[model samples]
Target: MSSLIEGYNYDIFISYCQKDNKHDGWVTEFVDNLKGELESTFKEEISVYFDINPHDGLLETHDVDESLKEKLKCLVFIPIISRTYCDQRSFAWEHEFIAFVEQASKDQFGLKVKLPNGNVAGRVLPVRIYDLDDNDVRLYESVLDTVLRGIEFIYREPGVNRPLKPDDDEKINLNRTKYRNQINKTANAVRDVITALEHYDHEPVTVAKDIFKPASIPSETGKTKIVTGSLILLALIVLGFFLLPKLLKSEGEPEKTIAVLLFQNYSGDPSQEYMCNGLTNEIIGHLYKIKSFDRVVPIDYVLPYRGTDKKPSRIADELKVNYILSGNFNTTRDTVRITAHLIDPRKDKILWQNGFDQPYKRIITIPADIATQIADCLKTNLTALEKQNIERIPTTNLEAYQLIQQTKNQFNTRTYESLNQLYDLSLKAIDLDPGYADAYAGAGSMLILTGTTFQHTAMQTVIEDALKLWRKALELDQNNASAHCGLALYNDWIIWDYIRAEEEFLKAIELSPNNQSFMKGYSEFLQKRNRLEDARAYKVKAEDDPIRIDILSLVLSGEKDEAHKYLNTYLQSKKIFAGEYFIWLEDYEAAKSICEAALQKKSQSMLAPRYQACLALAYYKTNDHHKAQMIIDQLIEKSDISLAGSPEFYTGWYYSGIGKIDSAFYWLEKAYKNRCPEIPWLKVDPGFKNIRSDDRYWDLYERAGHKAYDDYRAGLKRRKSNR
Candidate 1:
């Protein structure tokens, strides 16, 4: 179609049965339509070499091997798979299909080998244009199946900008469903093959089977033995039926789970909202530590019920918990009043109820007192250590408590203005009481986030300041879980100090064994280290706070679909801190959208600007560079944040997208200097995959401290040698 094709390479190769084309008169039309679609989609002239082309002399003289090889090198392959394609005389169809399959298999395996063996390979992708029945499909089953298994389908229809017809829609949907099922099967097959391929390099562990059976006895004793076995089986079944329930009853019923809903603001002054929320959260936190007692879900998980017309009983039932803790908090300028009641959802009875009035400042200790009283009433043993943990409030400074509450609230809003306000307030809290460990920890975390999100001019300076604050908090209170977690975040992301991060994370876990947030952060660190299995184990061990546990588990398991579902559901139902949670999962689009929505509600939120920047990167991921640039421009215009702090990290991503390798390398170097947390992930990151073979890329990877990359390469070499 273009003179450029003759000058350069093959554009398209049409492989079809000459008999089918000659008799049905449909093949030519199909070829022409496919060429048009390719041209339209790619916005370039595509030269299609059909076997049935009118240039008879050229076809006869065409170097079939060279032509197919050249076709394989092109962007796409169109294999016309009609019933007649199975004919042996169909050399075009046979040759093309075989070439496609061989290329695909070679690509999948050869590339892996070449990485270690210094060999080169080709890739093949397939396009199926005609329908064939089961028996007919069997003819080219190996080739078609291999191609289907190896490559993702790029769908194209005959019409221009036309929606599928009703029948066509049904057909396409059916095909898609079928394809998905086959692909899953193929994935499993590929996994098995890869596992086998690695066998020479490593020992294979035996997998436990679901069905357990005793080893069979010698077959000398047959009919009588079989009869005896049947009788014993019947007797065992009868025994099991009678004993299973009794055994379960003797073991006792499963522990009932309970959640405490946020206390209602009956004080009439909305300004006291923070006090009520803080009290509720503290109570939930206290109850959460009692692992031996009825489990208490976090108040954050239950906040979706507040202000809604739904009855407390209905809410409790929806959460599928046995009990509900509902309360109302009334506070004046000097004193606070609390009325709390625990209800049994199953029995629909109030199990416990209490009221307390204390000095407003002492409200911080109310949760421990209430929990102790409740545990006593329930006849549950509260170990001395557990009791101490519940009662432990790190700071008595009312100003610090108020600041922490406000900072947490603003952070949850996830807007740029809110984050700035939170930063200012947290700093003020620290200034008010320098010994406030929680304030310092919160400030450090916020500053680190600010450095990344807003492209702060003094990002490194801010992060360093954050690090100091966190270290100070830890020094003041060695067992402070939040402070330890903050230090871990700094070490892992900002300093590229993996060893320190790991130590801090492990220390945090040791100090606050049941703190789900700390466990999640630790799990994320393990993932970054390429210890996938260890990451999963830690995530599983994290406290089963639904939001935290589910999100962390999804991320560790690489279940992006489930993770997105859970996050969207949580965001729709409740207001909680999840911005960083989304970013950790690399769901930047969702994070940005959530932040933008929050901005609409709280216009001054500082977190919104950072989230907008995150969104720009997501756009970059999708190759919508214009949209990404626009968002970045908007952030620059609205905020005084400078890219210099984490310029390399951010610019590395932007330049990589535009194929500006040198620029990417420059920025990536800067990111490393700034200690951007994402540096370690660059090795396996598909964004840098294009430049991976470059010597500079390998140098960067080595500098990033991902020893696993070296291990992977070594593993590949071992595989090749074994082969």
Candidate 2:
């Protein structure tokens, strides 16, 4: 039978290994049930092609049947992916699976199509019956160019990895998925794919209602006048036919995903390159505010391509983005000249290009204007609030604006000196313009970072400085999202007040819902609170130490194997993560070796007190009290004031190791009063394990604003039923 959308042989083609059906006809049963579900789903007749007796046609590619090629030209190809289904030598894998992908990709609808409901689906739909190995999943994802997501049909258990049976007890299954629901989901997905294919070429109809209108000529018109009017009407129809589909696909939300790279400095001046980066960030910031742009890739993804001569298409291919917005910026005296090109990097073709020549004083307006133009060209509808935020000018004083931009550029360098430079620059920016909320917020965040990360200032001083600065920023601009985030971090790390932290987080989210970094912070905060399930629901991009964060999550959930695997990825570049996780796992000897190796290289102050403290703690744990004391003495000689949860916090660990319970609690309480960053990890931190049984520990744990220690541990045990 021909396909429902025409130019096709069948509506659905079921491809599988013949061995799959030999196991009590699992493949056959699934196909039968899918067909039954499709009948109720579609008002139109659904045609399905299923071969009961399949031949393993492993001959040359040319020997494959021409009729099978036509048969593979279906709307949806449901591959029954079993343990042996994806083998390279298999007939179905080569002839049906790969063949259909090549054929559909060249067809009118393409291999992947956007559904009417706005989700993208591939022509190859896998009904996976076996949990796939990582290599196999990667192989499939390479071809699909997306994560391997599909309807899972496997019944999982401690040792079982097989096809789910129709009569299987779902309550006992690890997957907790019924066999019938899988079939229904498959049918619905097939319907979505086919329905989208049917209407793919006719999307212009949805928008043509507004563009194409009938024209009425006067009854007494002259012949030339009537002809002219009719020609104008014909021209309008032609324009709608030619332009509307390209403009209004997905109802003004095109399926193009994009990243705006740092614009190049056309002035041939290195100093001006920062200006280009500032513009890039401004454009990206504006794009993020546009709610219709659901797939705007973050600037972090494009940072590696900053000074490279790589083609936009090549960059897009590596970034897994289809669109690349790249440009060049030049300012000559009073005028700023900027050129931008929105390119479909897959085809290496420029979809849109424009240049702006405006006064350098008005340079702040260009990024927003360019963003809106690109959005318009892509047919993405924008909210009024989004437009306002993008267009709103910050500080009419251009020097202060430029200082703020320069201040923002320092952190991207990631130098040890960048934090101090960032703080100084932000302070200068605020001095120039007292009303600059972002600068104030940046200054406040830097205080916390420099104080905790590098011990440049006292913890108490950092908290006081940050709160005042952050509060002043918010007072200046109530809509400032940066100030809100700074306040959230203050409450999260310094105060350990979960309620206020969450309130600030929610406020920041309300102001900037598309700010993924905020969501990522909130996700970590939720995980810290042990709301594991809730934390998993928000998938956001992390800014720094992403693998460490992942390892932290895995370790908390008692997935030591997974945590170690992630930690190994950061072994060379960031050994601190491995050392930290090792200590948590009680592998002090390994931690000692790593910290020692790390200390042997570079300046003593490079990662001061961090590896030193870790190394000292490792020594104490291994019963080498003398080596521990020596390192502790070195840290003590360097500073009378402790930084982060360190030095004094380190002293507390050494005391705890030596069974000095009173001394340990004393230093710990001091760290707690200063709101040590490590206080929030009270329940899981192995540092205080020796003193945890003491009454003072529970009082301190609860005082640090966490749930009661005993109750919290009970909750953890309840939530995690031995994984």
Candidate 3:
């Protein structure tokens, strides 16, 4: 902990009305961007307090008030003021704002303080989202008795009266400077105020001569020394009795940060690799159940290191972990041998090593056995929930579990043929054990991959089938994270149930908090919804999968030049998102080259068709309608009503690029009707520019549930005069 934060429970507290967070979430975005800006501004970790549940009832509940009072010992308080925020007699204003004002005024240090920059500001920092009613404005002034010189997030242009919407990012409007810049200013102001507060708190306490007279004793120093000495003795006694034991217990414990490298396959058969990988994944799953663990490297991040010559020490350095778990698995016809080692990478010492042979039928217990051993070695206790998780088995049938494991391993390949085989194996597992939740989850995943991997003639049917499998899996076991993820995808993409999708996504994360796939999927979902700031927050959580989402972060942060540089480096190994970046940067030739190259290299890949779609769009941008039309015809031939909705969206993109508004609108409508997940991105998509003026665009946009698009279209008229 930094000295600046020693006395404060939180560096910042965000106060806002629940209504301001509705409709794609304005308050959510504001907090996300502010948190990011603060992280970038400070070197030390900063704690921010924000309560999402509006009905947590700060005044009604004693527990809530106790928590809030402790949190209110913060360095800065940010109140997001809007018309709704001011007018409503909500806890945000009456309990939080007024309460904090009264608390700060009666404090010994006072409410107003001179900052290091020679400016006096109150502790309650206001953030205006709208020019409020005169009476509302007077309310804040009357409480604080200072001019409300707060940060403004809204466009204060002439004739403009509403808050900024997400869709304003699309068009090149002079008044629309990047939203991040306004967030930066607010974050910086909060940081300044916090620093000044820290300085004030750290200042020496001075006694006023007029307030208190010294004792009329000749030996004043002698009396002071006696009192101070007695206090020191009392403190030492308390420290010895209570705090020393805990300090010593913590000191002797191992560092909680660890990374598990991919388990080596000693069977010497490439076909049996899946079993080893699955064992490794199961071990990691068990490890994450331990609440005391700060960080446990996920399997996806460690998979690339398998069969490589990389040293464990170097791996630990890259992962920023103190300990490493490495082991190997070898299986015979009816039994398996496992050797495990825990190493302190920095010192190159093996803290623990063990070998065990267990019957193949009892393979499901291996993870729990290993996790228990490691927990004992580290002197960590397993909570009841974690213990139960370790003991739970996915299926009674061992063969079915093995089949599910093998199928999951195929997903790492990311090829059309591999996914097809995975789908077949998943069904085989389900046939083997109909009551198996893991098998059902595997089956549901296969359906989604199949919909995305192939040219589907009936995409909706495939998605519906997948959704049924996900529900069945949950019926078998409500704690299945994979099933929750499958349902989240189906809800977001197929059913267009935005709220349900978020709920399912959050449920998946709650079930398996360390899973990177759920994190990445939710981040992408937020991005498509034009909640880039929220996307950034999730992207930070999904840091293990860096290459997958870095481009989007750079582009959204107004770092196109940096994104281009990264794209060049990123394209060296894979061409998977390079075309999208090139398109965003308006480099049609570069986009065309990469997409064409990928199509030629892996023509049978599930991703190849999407790359081909990108190629067609690039060709259209380059005015090569002849080649672009030829590719579009091929895609149309392959696409049916049942496939994933990508083909329809790409077709729409091609038509929109070529100035065919009717055709573009037709395909876009089809995309929406089919529940194409890509439809969520339509508002911010560059290709939609030419058709945005058409009434049909608004119709489809509204049908796609993008209120931001409607708001942006309405606000375009006031752009030029805002400056």
Candidate 3, residues 114-183, lDDT tens digits: the string is 5674445566788888756435664576566544548766652323545665455512321233466668
Go through the candidates in order and give each one's C-alpha lDDT.
Answer: 0.57, 0.72, 0.70
Ranking by TM-score: 2, 3, 1
Worst 10 residues of 3 by lDDT: 209-218
Which model scores highest in lDDT?
2
Q: Write the per-residue lDDT of candidate 1 for residues 426-471, one digit (tens) a residue.
A: 8999888888877888888777666653344455567667767776
Which has the better TM-score: candidate 1, or candidate 2? 2
Global CA lDDT of candidate 2, please? 0.72
Q: Which model is ahead, 1 or 3, in terms of lDDT?
A: 3
Off by over 4 Å in 1: 1-252, 288-296, 331-334, 373-385, 409-417, 452-459, 533-641, 644-647, 654-663, 708-723
